[model samples]
Target chain A: MIGTWTLFQRESRRFLRVKMQTIVAPALTAILYLIVFRYAMGDRQVPGLDVDYFSFLIPGLMMMAMLQNAFANTSSSMIVGKIMNVHVFLLMSPISAAEAVFAFLAAAVLRALVVGSVLLLVLLPFSDLSLAHIWMILFYGVCGSLIMGSLGLIGGMWSKTFDDMAMVNNFIIMPLTFLSGVFYSVSQLPPFWQAINAWNPFFYLIDGFRHGFIATGDSDPLQAMGAVAILTILAVLSAWYLWRIGWKLKE
Target chain B: MNALEINNLYKVYGNGNVALQDVSLLVPEGSFFALLGPNGAGKSTLINILADTVNASSGSVSLLGHDLFHERAWCKRRMGVVPQEIAFDPFFSPREVLKFSRGMYGQKADDAWVDELLERLELTQHAHKITRQLSGGMRRRLLVAQALVHRPKLVILDEPTAGVDVELRKRLWDFMRELNAAGTTILLTTHYLEEAEELCDQVAIIDQGKLITSRPMKELIREVASSSLCLRYAEPLQLSDEDKSILSAFSPRVYDNQLCLTLNKQDSRSDFDTVYQAAKQRFGTPVDVSIRQEDLEDVFLRLTGDSS
Candidate 1:
């Protein structure tokens, strides 16, 4: 357990060391999403709601930052390990697969939290978003981060090249996050797109996170929790399986 | 009990490349065993198997009498591995690296020992610098220092001095010899046959994933030390074609200023003097003759020839 925590601590130190890349960059990207959504639809109001566009987009932006950074943390770390061949240092020790998985997942969650915190801080002055349920906000934020981070671990383990990793990020993760109601609500979409959004896991994460900022949309908090929980469980299991198989790790 | 034992180890890659085949060797307690092989000769694979970084398809590896696959943590605690690759996170200082390695091995942090390792490896000056900031040679020494942080009973170094300079290489061999003297069994895999010849008590040569030979250094070298004598004369020697042909039967060669001969068991000291006297009398100038013993490279070439 101490070994696991030490690994986590080492990763956290690395996170702090590269704050410009890990923290500032994601927060900057989130701020860009805010500016674009605010400018394009500032005066526009939803069909049955009075919320401003910036206010509505804040939670989604936070969730996006949380998810992307979480994924980036694990994937980038592992890819760097591969490129530098520094992974032998970790493997030559007595650290187990379980410990490695937890440490990486924990680091991913921490990176997500840092970026999410920065996003929330930067948006507080510009938007009228309120904190309705802080617990829901915290739970979904961490859960979403874990899910993405674990997926990143799986991607990193599966990737033999940087291009392979970019494919997962650009094609799979980007498309899912974009179509999961980041810029718009699923209710406004047609039936086909609505069903696709319903199946998208990011939809629940953003919907749950939005519940914390506003009094809500997209789904019930109970359903949101269940969705994110299932996705997190599945992602964790896959990451653990990859580690067990020593996918690209032992070879 | 042997400090390390490998029995019929085997590894076959998915593509059917046999990285190791029935490879077996033992490092007795407090022995400095050298595993010598050329590139792609399964040396790294053997080291990886013992380090538990790579799995074997068959046979077994035991460290300190504990099964490597079953008692991984227990065996790992007693073993240290300095892998061939110079690997270190650029984010960490040498001190942090040592601390982390020690902690990972389930050993309590001992600043004194860590300091000693740093001092011994001459990494104290750069102990606080991130790995990326250090010079290449310093990084190599840190690899050695990192492996020693846990005070493991067995230290396995896989080409630790491959890129290092002569001074650092000698320093490592001296440090390793001291460690062996202190009861830590050392296993080294290297391409430097001369280094192995000088440093290792027991040597094993592997070829094409198989253990070609394993024997004590002195015994192996002595068994293969076919002596050679080279004669250098002050004046050119003229001989008939038939006489030159007769000299060629002794495996003799004339080049530059010398005549070389393959010293055989049948050639006695009197025979050497007679040949020298005859060459001097024929050339009308005294001939200088010398004999030298064969080294490990000769033995390695003879045993594992240039097949692959």
Candidate 2:
């Protein structure tokens, strides 16, 4: 337990030491999205939803920031450690593979929550959004971060270099987050696109998160919750399995 | 009890490279043991397996009687590894590195002990400096300090002095000798045969993934029964036919006015007297003469056949 906590603390300090890149940059990116999209859309109402476009977009943008930063936190750390050969420090220690997985997950989740809170606080005065259900907001924020963090761990473990990590972020993570209805509701898209969005796990994360703020979303709340739960479980289990097998970590 | 023991250890990589081939050895408690081998001879592979950085394909390892695979955590808590390559979080200070390492081993941070290590390694002034900014020798010292932070009973140093300067290497050996005197079992893998001969009590040599020899340092040195005699003359003297015939039997060679003769260890004294008499009668007494006995280098070269 002490080893796990020490690893978590060290990993957290690693990112927090570079707040400009890990926290502030993502927060600034979120705010920029809010300003640019709000002005372009001009107070229009989201189709089939009572809230205005900006209000609905706020939750999506916040969740997106959380998810992206969470993923970046773990993936960047892992890739850098691998490149620098610093992973030997952890490998030579008494920490178990399971403990190492948990430490990385905890650090990623912490960074995500920190970025999410900063984005929310920075955008609160500008937007007329209210937390309709605080518990739902907490649930979606944590579960959504967990999903991305776990993906980041898997990607980090599998990648051999910075370029490989970037490929995963650009091709896989970026496409999923953008097409998951962050800028526009899935209901506004064609039936074929909506069907595709229904299968994306990011869609549930965004829909569930937006449901927390506006009390309404494009998907069924219960089904979205189930999807989030299942994806989170699968992601966690896969990361743990990879860690235990020492894939790309040990020789 | 032995500090370390291995049985039929084998490591076959994914590409089918056999790094360790049924290697086994034992290091007695409180011994300064040396693992000497040529490059690609599986020295690093064996060290990595013990450090838990690499897994073995088949076999077993035990550290102080604890199974390395099954009781890994327990064994790890009692061992420290200083790897060949310098590995540290660049952003972290030396103090933080030590603190974090102590914590990783489930040991509470002891500022006094850490300070003592820093002082002993001559790193007190650079304790708070970012590791990336430290000089190479400083970084190497920090690596040593990090390994000793948890006070492990057994310490493994893999090429600890590979790139260090003479002064720093001497200091490191001094520190290591002190630690060994305090009862820490030290396991070292080095390419420097002189270092092993100077410091280690037990020596093991591996070649082509096989343990070629494992014995006490003196005993191993004694196995090679050859010595050399080097005689330097004050002036260059042309060898007479009689001198040539007398020296040719011992394979004597002349370089820079010095005649070198290789002799069997048992006949070295008599051979020296014979060579001295012949040289004196021919050259009217040389300027200086010295006898060089067979050291670890001769034994190592003979066993591994790696003269280069």
Candidate 3:
């Protein structure tokens, strides 16, 4: 635990010192999405959401920041280490796989929170958002970040070249998060699209996040929470298993 | 007890290339052991296995009586490694880099010791400079200082001096010797035979993923006593028919204004006397002869074949 905390602190220090890359960059992305989406659909209101389009977009924007920052934290960290050959520093240490996973995930989640909080604060002045259920917001936000962070770690570990990592981000992660009904409710979609969204784990993340904005959701909160719990467990398990095997790292 | 031992290690990559093949060796306690090999000879694989950065396909390794796999955590804490490549977080200063590395090893912060390492490696002046901006030699020194941050009992350096200039290489060697004298067993791999010959008491050679030979440096040197003799002639001495007939006996070659000979492995005393006598008779005056005793390079070439 001490070892994990030490690594976590080091990672935090690295990100903090380079705030433009870790904080300002992600916040800028959130602001861009806000300007574009708010202009395109500002006055429109969804049937069951009980808010303007910007309010709905705020949750999605927060979730986007959470996901992207989580992915960037681990992927950038590992890939940079691999490229610089400084990975030897970590590889030669006494830190175990468990400690490594803990450290990386912790740092990723922290970045997610920082970025998410900034988006929320910046958008708060422009909208009338109720603090309907802060607990649920925190829960799903943290869980969504963990899932993406763990996925980033798996991507970083399995990639031998930078191109492999870039491929994972562009081809898999981006498409899923964008098409997961972040802007509109899945209930309005046709049967085929709804079926696809049902299988998407990101759909559940946004659905759970939107739940915190209102008292109820189009889907059951319990179901989305269950999905997140299961995904988080799988991410932790896969990371732990990879570490034990020393998968790409050892050989 | 051996400070490090490997028995029948094997590593077959997923792509079906064999990286290590039935390799095994022992590093006795408190001795500087050099694992010498060619470019693709599995030196990195062997080192990675001990460091737990690479898993072996089969067999076992132990460090200070601790199993490398089963007791990996404890074994890891007892060893340090300086990898051949200079890997660093470019954004960090030398001090931050060392502090982070020390923390990763599960050690308490020792500012004085870390500062001393930076000082010894001649990096104290650049402690606050970001790593990416440092020159190649400074980067190499930073690698060495990072490896020693945790104060492990055994330190392994894999080609730590590959591209370093002569002055820095000598400083690295001196620091390594000091560590060895202080009872930190040093294990290294190098292409520089002179470095291995001068520093390592025990030497192991690997080729094509297999262990070629392991012996004391002195014994290996002594085993290859086909002394190299270079003769500078006053005028180019033409090889007479008689000299040509016996030339194969000495493995002679002529270049520019000199003749070089590698006497047969088991050259008879009479053979050397004959070559000297023939040279004098053919040239009508004795040539200036310089005899150099066999060294590790000779043994290395003999066992691995000469490329240089």
Candidate 4:
């Protein structure tokens, strides 16, 4: 447990040491997103959410920040350490596989929450968000962070170059984030697009998390929570298994 | 008890490159051992395996009487590794790095120990500086400090002085000697044969991923029974056929008006004496003459076929 905490400490310290890239940059980007969307689509309401566009958009954007930051935290750290060979400390440490995986995920979740909080704080005055259901908000935020952080770790292990990491960011994570009803409501989409969104697990993450803020969601909150919970365990377990087997990490 | 014992260790990388091949070694407790090898001879691979950075394809490594593969956590807590590469995290200061390493090694935080390590390694002045602000030698010293932070029973140092200066090297060795005297087993790999000859009592040579020889330092040096006579003059010696014939017996080579002649085999006293008289007769009153006994460098080159 001490080992895990130490690793977690190092991870958070690493991110905190570079606040510009890890925290401030994401916060700035979120603020910019709000400004641009609010001006471009002034005073609009979602087709079915019946909520002001900014109010509906705030929680979704927070979830986006949560997911992206969580993913970026672990992926960037892993890839940089692997490339620079400083990960020798990690490999040579006595920390167990579970401990290592949990540390990375824990730090990721911590960063995600931090970035999400900053977004919420900055965007609060602009929207009429209820900020309801605090339990659901914390639950979905943590779940999303864990899942994205796990993916990031796995991707980092699989990547050999920054370009490879970018491929994941550009082709997969970006597409998923933008297409997951983050800026608009899923009910407004056509049947085919809705079906496609149903397949994207990210949509469930955003819907469940947004429902926490406004009690408005396209899917059953209970079902989405269950799916996210299972995915979180599976993702974290996959990370642990990789570390245990020394997959592209040890040798 | 042996500090570390490996039996039939073999590692074939994922790309089918064999890094280690049936290599076995024993490092007795409190012994200063050297694992000498040329480049690409699997020295780093072996050390990495012990450090748990590289997994052995097949082998059993007993570290501090614990099975490394079965009780890795136990082994890791008792061993520290100084790898060949110079890698440090840019985010952390030297002090944080040491604290983090101690924690990673399953040791409680000890500021006194950390302070002692910093002062010993001459890194106290740079403890709060970010890693990027440190010089190469300073970074290397920090690596040494990090490896020693946990005060492990066995420490593996892989070419720790590769780029360090003469002064730091001296200080580093003194610190290492102190650790060794305190009963900490040390496993070292170095290209500097003279340093190895001076420090290590047990020597092992690996070439082309196979152990060529492992022996006591004295015994290994004794096996290469050879000597060289070096002759120098104010003017280069112009050798005729007769001079060539007499000097050829010693396999002479000239460099900057100096003649270095080697007697390949040293066991025969009469042979050396006869050649000495012949060379003396051929080159009369040379400016200076000196003989050097064969050392570890000669033994290493000869046994490894001088492949490096």
Clashing pairs in 4: none
DockQ of each: 0.61, 0.70, 0.69, 0.72
The TM-scores, one per candidate, come to: 0.89, 0.90, 0.89, 0.91
Query: What CAPRI grade goes to candidate 2?
Result: medium
Least lDDT summed over 10 consecutive residues: which range in candidate 1 chain B?
Answer: B261-270
> Which lDDT tens digits does candidate 2 get at residues A38-124?
889998998888889999988898888889988988888888888878888788899987898889889988998898888888888
Fnat of candidate 3 is: 0.78
Q: Between the candidate structures 1 and 2, which one is better when assessed by DockQ?
A: 2
> In terms of lDDT, which candidate is stronger, 2 or 3?
2
In candidate 3, what are the lDDT values of residues B105-165, reduced to their tens digit? Answer: 7888899999999989999999999998899889888888988998988999988997889
Candidate 1 residues lying further than 4 Å off, grouped into runs, are A48-50, B229-291
| Index of the highest-DockQ prediction | 4
Write the number of the candidate with greater TM-score, choosing between 1 and 4: 4
lDDT of 3 by residue, A128-239 (tens): 8766888888888989989998998889888888999999999999989988777787878899988878889988887788779865556787767877998998998898
Candidate 1 local lDDT, B1-308, one digit each (tens): 99988899999987899999998888898889999877899999888878766878999888878888888878887888998888888888999999988887777779999999999999998899989999888998998988888999999999899789998889889999999999999989888888888888998999899999888988998877776566777755444576566665444445556665455565344356555554555454545768756578756754675512
Question: Please, what are the lDDT tens digits per residue for candidate 4 over residues A41-69?
Answer: 89987887668888888899889989999
Better of 3 and 4 by TM-score: 4
CA lDDT of B216 in candidate 3?
82
Q: lDDT (0-100) at residue B241 of candidate 3?
A: 66
